[model samples]
Each structure stands twice: as structure tokens, then as C-alpha cells.
Target: MNIHDRPFFAPTRRLALGLTGVLLALTVAGCASGSRKPQPTPLEPVAALVSARQVWTQAIGPVDPLLVPAVHGGAVALANAAGMVTVLEGETGRVRWRAEAGAPMGAGVGFDGRRVALVTRANDLVVLTERGVAWRQRLPSRTFTPPFVAGERVFVLGGDRSVAAFDAQSGARLWSQAPRGTEPLVLQQAGVIGAVGNTLVVGIGGRLVGLDPDDGRVRWEAAVGRSRGANEIERLVDLVGRVGRDGDVLCVRAFQSAVGCVDAASGRTLWAQPADGATGVQADAERVYAVEANGRVMALRRSDGARVWANERLLHRGVSAPLALGRSLAVGDAQGFVHLLSRADGSFLNRLPTDGSAIVEGPVLVGNTLVAVTRNGGVFAWRPE
Candidate 1:
């Protein structure tokens, strides 16, 4: 008998028949009782604490829900769903250059100072220089996380729980390494890769692995969260959002599990605190900021992982990842409102409105300018006065 076809309790054939009848009766009873899943909390208007104005706006075509803009040097590189890549002046929002890909973009517009890399929906990697297309290569598997470019290498996390590196100048494959354990269930929106010193930090399967960039060898691995519960769904604990790093500290959040920090060099866990967030965490020098799955914004002490403060007024507002900006933390909501909260107390400091569409991805902090992209392909930049 298929385990999924029948409830676990109905192990015997006779019990399975009876369980089916009982389940039907219970389903009818539940319907009669008018049981329903809990609805998200309604959004409430809050008075702005400070004034934030948009410096500029640009229409770049609709962006993929999983991809975020890449900022390098003083330019921001963005790829829309239609395979158009635009490089803009970070402060002025002036379009510097634009390129169109042969296929729809799947993963990134990961930019270093030299080259830009993006994956196509056809599972091909396309690299571009300032002039035009540099090279194109096929990936071994699909990818949702944006490609990470550092030094002379570009790194990507694939759907098959593997991390691969390629030459930044040429499209040659450097090395590919898969994570340990069973082919664990992966989260669709929960993988990230970046460089911290000489180590490549990858968030996958509820853990963070520090890999040597030169050879893609696992230098160390640290668990952000562990699997628990009876079923695979409940046991899912992949790390969500971007892995945050500040100096020697690295922080990450696990889906519906916990948030933790670790020493980047030694792989020693600094601290892990229970947190229920679907998105990732961002860090400044002192605090790590995160949005809980239900839209609660939280600030945790970076040193020991203690709760600094939390604001729940935006609960269920579909908050994006938090961006740490000096004394404030900025997060976007479903309604295209970019909220700035006090880093000290989590109080609302200011709010800015976009094109009235949902800000699906978190804002990127380029220098002092906060850049945000809405679901409708609206891009805006703001700086705190």
C-alpha cells in the first residue's frame, strides 16, 4: 500500500478501508463546521516618522521574482524577465548601458567590475562584458539563486544541491561540489552564494558551507537549522534569503526555523536564535535584521544573537528582506511601501511609496543610496536626509 494514499495509522488492509470511510466523514464534518485556514492580517496605515522621497525612477521591464539587482563599483546591474540587462548609475539612476540576451533570463545579472553573468531559462549561462556578449555555456542543472562573481570566478547554486564555479574571464567550468546527506528537499526561494575573504559562502539545505574559492573544496560547514518532525514538509529547513556577512561574522536564516551567526574563518557557530522567517537576514556592523514569514521585522544583536527589538505592525503585509542602513532598517511590503524603522527600537522612522505594486525583492544598499525594485518593474532610489 502507498504510504501517501492512506494515513500512517491505517497500516493494515482492513484498517485502511475503515480509515477511508472515517476520513470522508471527518471531511464532511469539517465542512459543516465551516473550518478555514487563517487569513493574513489586514494592513493598517501608520504615520510616517520621517520623510523619504524618490530620487529617480526607471522602467526596466518586469523582473523575475527570484532575482535581485547586483551592485558593483558604482553601478547597479539588473535583469528583467524578458532577458534585458541594464546597468545604471547607482546614485543618479541613469542608464549606462543595456543588453538583450538571446533567451529569457533565469537567474542573475551578477556583476563584478569586469563581467556580468546571467542564466537563461534554457539552463544556459550567458556572460557579458561592457561591450556585448562575452561567452555562453550550458549549466548542468537549473538555478534559482543569482550567480555570484568574485575575483576571477563566478559561483552558482544549482537545483540539484550542487555548487559550481566558472572562470570569470572565460566560461570554463572550474569545479562543482555537491552537499552532503540525502538529496535533501530544496527551497525554491531559499538559496544564496557570496564571497567572504577567500571563502565562498553558500546557503543550502538548512546549512551554510564555507568553500575554498580556488578549487570549490569544502573548507567547513555549519548548520543553520536542523530537520525535525515526521513528514518531509515539516522537516524542511533550508536557509532562506541572502547570507549576510560583516567582517568575520556570517549570518543566515532558516525557513520556519532559526537564525544564526558563525565565525567565517573557523566555522565556529557564534549563536543561533529561534526565528520563524521565510526570507533572509541582513547585517550592519552591530545588528542583524530580518523579516519573519508573517511580516514581522526583527533586529538581533550580532554579537550574541539576542533579540534587540521586533515590530509586528506590518504583520502579514508580505514584507521583503530587511536592508540595514546605518541607524535605520529598510524593508519593502507588498503594497510597494519601503519602510524605514529605527535600528535601535524597531519604531517606524519613515516610509516611501513606489509604483503601488508589491516590492517582491529586498532593497539593495549601494553606498548611502537605498535602491528598491517593485514587482511591476518599477525601480526607485532613496537616500535618508
Candidate 2:
């Protein structure tokens, strides 16, 4: 579900099913007028500036906010909401192994070459290897982000905004932490957890925090976005995923607030630009790309977060987070079309058609293959030829 329909947390009374959802629903209903929305920006003819083709596709059933393709080299592990996890050889769209997690999945498919970690709908952290389900243990709360796998350990960023680490082999709990934040509402989206060298980093509220992976000690914390709204709904500024990483640098998009880059090595805020975007960002060495909440595309210079260019051709099309691909960038729309744009100018290059459903998550790149998953369970792979 999109942000306007995503669930939110109220500190005192957070319901499991119906009411936590109404928090954002109330925001949308309370904020917007009854005026009918105008149509999405019409598509124009595209002159293919680059040669790219969809090479192969696989069906993994429908997906949701969960199911980020956990990519390792050319292999990608993906799961559907129904608990079917499939590992694919990305280069050829070949299935390496498909297994069941034995329950409905809440969030998942965190793969680090060998092991896969998933949070089940029952609040269980399930770890799987090629041999099958390795170990399963219950978690303290719900999790939306996929478990982050690194250094032979699996990290879980919980829906309650806590951080925990688990042993990949025996499912042993190493450390659990509750970051210091008193925000009443949080976005029900993918968890942002990653590693930069020895420091373990996680997105908690509006800050990207570096913690000692061994003992859950806070090394540093950098604020990428700040809360400023009159109410909790307007003040939601948690950093979303589709983050761009170059060595120690992480380029991220703060929900409904700003887009910024953080030097994960030193926990320093390199620069943050005021950007009203809901999705995350993708970056290359020179520039970072983001899709605005209403579908405007932007290219920001990587050095100081300067706006390089803006393109509104896809405005209101429900575009996914961008995937930087060589001289072009790729994004999928709600209509199941992948648009390739010129990296230097944000101009349209070409559009590729899918199964006519929304791309549920961001586009991913594995090896030379550009990958995208749709809401209808279509997994497509494209390659430049």
C-alpha cells in the first residue's frame, strides 16, 4: 500500500488490524478536499536512446510493501505474502530453490549469498538455507522491513522502531535495543538496515544511527530529516529505502520531508535538500535520483545534494523508486510500465510494459540484469543489448 493508505502508530493505543491503519487514512481524509484528482500526466512518444530488452520473467504470486528482492550477486531471493520464498538466478530467470516458510510472511527475503531471513506474519523470525528452513524464533513485535543479512548475522528493524540481531545459524538472539525516540507515529514500510564497514546502521525515526554491532551501542546518530508539522501525521519523517550506497556514503529519502546523504563512516550529515517525496532514492557516483510523492522525477548532484534537474513526465503515475542503470535510470509505474530516462537530463528514453499491474516495490539491479516485481506476481528481468 502507498503512504496515504499505510498504517501508523499512536503511542497510547496502537491497534493490530483496523485502527492503526486509520491513522494515515484519517490524515488523507482530513487533509484532502473532495475535489477529484486530475488525470496522471499523459505519456508522449519516446525515442529509444538506449538498447534494452526484457530477457526473462518469473511469477512468484502477488507482493506487497514487503518482498524486496534480496539480491546477492546474480541470485535474488524473493517471497510472496503467502510465504512462498523463491531464489532465482537473476541472469537467466532460473529458479535456484523455492520453499515455504510455513506461515504467511510479514516481511522478508533478506539473503546474504547462503542464508535467507524472513519475518513471518505470526511475528517469527525465520531463517533459511539451501537445505531448507534452518531455524525459526518468535520476535517481540511486528516488522515491516526485510531482515538485513550481513556478517553472518541477521538484523531486524521492528515496527515498534526497535533494533535486534539474531544468529543466522542457531537463531540465537544476540542483542535487542530500543532507540531513544518518542515519536507517536511511524510508517508501516520496509525497514532500513545496512552495514558500512564495521559499523551497523539503521534508520530510526528521522535519524540514521550507527551502532556497535557487537553490543548494540550507539556510535553516532545523524539526522537526515526533522519533524516540523503541527501534528504527528505531518511530522512523519522516517527514512525510506531504495537507498544508494557508495563506500561509506548512504543517500536516503526521508518520508514527506527531505532527501539527504549521510556519511555512514562518520555519522555526519553531508547534505539534505528539502524534497517532498515518499519513496526512497537511487544514486550513482555523480548524482542521486528520486521520485516525488506526486511522481515528479529529480536528479540531485551527489556532492552537495543540489538539484541537477527535474522531470514531471511521469507525474501522478504512481512511480516506483528509481533504479540507476548506466547512462539511464529505470522506474516502474502503477500501470506496470517501466520507464527509462536519460541520467544526464531526466528525459524519457523508452517505456517497457509488464503484466499491467503496479510495481509494488523499487526496481532492483543484479549483475547486468535490471529486475522489477509487480503487484500481480510478475518478476521481469531486463538487460541492455
Candidate 3:
């Protein structure tokens, strides 16, 4: 018998089954009594990373807004849902400049040299050089990754799974690929990184696809996660990973179990090892690290994907992306605790607190200052001393 069809037992299981069954059954039949699931434990506060005097707080927009900031040149550029991109000085909460662009959506902002490029909801590549319109190209479908600018060439992927290359100077399309899927998820930039050589590692349809920087040719392909259930769509959603490349090792979040490492040149699986939770993946010279969604931090060897160490304390249910800052590894959780782990053994080094607030968006690291954007409309910065 199907799991959802099974009779509910305890209140916790009954609530969970009822919710799942309602989605499948489309209506609740007979519930002897309505029962609510036990609420998850309230997240306790982690220690602060900086002293109270060192804290800086600011408001950008509404609560739960998708105003993710992109760090560049000691400044954080935030894009609002209304298609406005605002540049803010990193050290202070002062706004440098703001410009209105396209309709607000969840596209990303990219940087090449001093220019800021935004992918609009209209599927257009808008390039802003020195805060001015450098050029704009109207594509056929929406784009999610801020144009991958490599030198003068900007590589972009559309909702159709077709990768296109355009001249950065002009909006001239150099080449384009055919659409891959009817409802392709390639438009979402899962993970992108320019490798050591002329190789570019991109997550296409939740799978890691390597391409040559010279021309957008598929050099290699590696599946990062295993398929789940029978439906193709359900399996694709579980194949989530933010890929990274250091030298020749391709680092990606395989599953909740481990980070999968493959040879960048040959597309061969080197190894896969255990991690704390399903988190973001990052890499440096020494190790490949993941900050599991449950806020645990883990480090693995880059050569064979072997576990180096892992720390789960001071972490929350949801966590931020891992930052491999050579000697230190940083991650922030929803509970507002940003932990710094030693790259050598994954030992806890410092904790950056969020002043009792929760981090909803980021634990972005630029230099020594780690910025945590909170859910209570506060952006807190911490520099562990």
C-alpha cells in the first residue's frame, strides 16, 4: 500500500499524512478528530561574532523581500522585486546609487570588471557599465543567471535550455543552442564557476555540464544527484547543487549524504563522502566544503572527496552557502548564528551572532566582513576578531 494511504497513527504522523494525503486525495475524507502537528522546536540563539558596539543595522525594503545583494568592490548591490538595482557602500549602510530597470523577478546580478549586469524578467540581458546602459539584448525566454561574463564574451542560458553567447561590447548573438526540455530547469542558475583552465562548470537541469570558455561546447557532463520516485519532474527537483571548481576537481552537493567530486577534465567521479546536511558547496585549494541546509559545516578532501571533519552545533535547520576563504570556512543559519570553522580540521573557531534576529537571505562574505541579511528587516555585519 502507498505510504500516504496508510491509516494515521500518532498526532505527528497523522498531521503529516493528512497534509500529504490532502495533496493527493484532493479532499480529507474521515478524520476522527482534527489534530495539529507538533510545531518544530524554536531555534535557540547562537553566540555573537562581534561585540555590540561593532554591529551595524539597516533596512533595504519590505519584509521577506527578494532583495539579494551582490558584493563588488567593497560595495553590496541589491536588486528589488520592482526591477530596481541599488548600490550600497559596504562599510556603511549608505546608498550610493539606484536605477530602475525591468520588472521585478528572481534573476541574478553579475559583475565583470566594474560593470554590473542584470538578467531581467523579460528574458533580456541588461548590461550596466559604470552604472549606465552598456547594452541590452532581448532574448526569447527569461534568464536567471547574471550573464556569465568572461572577458568580452557573455554566456547566458534561457528557460529553453539553450545556452547563448553574445558579444559584451555589442548585443550581437555569437551562437545559440537548441532548447533541451519542454519544461527545462536549466534557466535557473544552479551553480556556475570558471575553472582553472579554459573550462567553465555550469549546472544544467540540475546536472553539472562542463563547457569550454573559448566556445560554448559541452566538454563533459556529470550527474550530481540520483533520481527519485518514478516521475521525472520530481526527481529533477531533488538534484540540487551549487557546483564549484578548484584546479581540476569539480565539487558539487550530491545529496544530503555528501558532496560529489569529479575530475573536471574527464567527468569521472573521484569520490563522494558524508556531510552534515543538504547545504551549499564551496571549494578552495585544500578542501571541498558544504554547509548543510540544517546549518552543519563539513570539509572533505578535494582529491577523493573524503571527509575531513564536520561540525553541526550552533547550526539551524536552514543554512547559508559556504565560503571557502582559503584558511577559514564561514556559514550562517536561519537562527542567526554564523560559524567560522578551521579549514584544517573543521573545528569551530568563532561565532557571528545576529542580535537575536534570524538570517533569511544571506551570510555573504566579502573580505573579512560576513554580512547576514535578517528576516526582521536588518542586515548585520560581523568581523570575528
Candidate number with greatest lDDT = 2
TM for every model, in the order presented, reads 0.87, 0.91, 0.73
In candidate 2 the C-alpha lDDT for residue 218 amounts to: 94
Give the Cα RMSD of candidate 3: 10.9
TM-score of candidate 3 on Cα atoms, chains taken together:
0.73
Cα RMSD for candidates in order: 11.0, 6.0, 10.9
lDDT of model 3 at position 255: 35
C-alpha root-mean-square deviation, candidate 2: 6.0
lDDT of 3 by residue, 40-127 (tens): 2454454443232344666654322223346665776655555566666666667677666655544556554455566776656777
66-92: candidate 1 lDDT, tens digit per residue: 667788767888888888888888789
Best prediction by TM-score: 2
- List clash counts for every candidate, in order: 0, 1, 5
Q: Between prediction 2 and prediction 3, which has the larger TM-score?
A: 2
**Poorest lDDT segment (10 consecutive residues) of candidate 3:** 9-18
Better of 1 and 3 by TM-score: 1
lDDT of each: 0.74, 0.79, 0.55
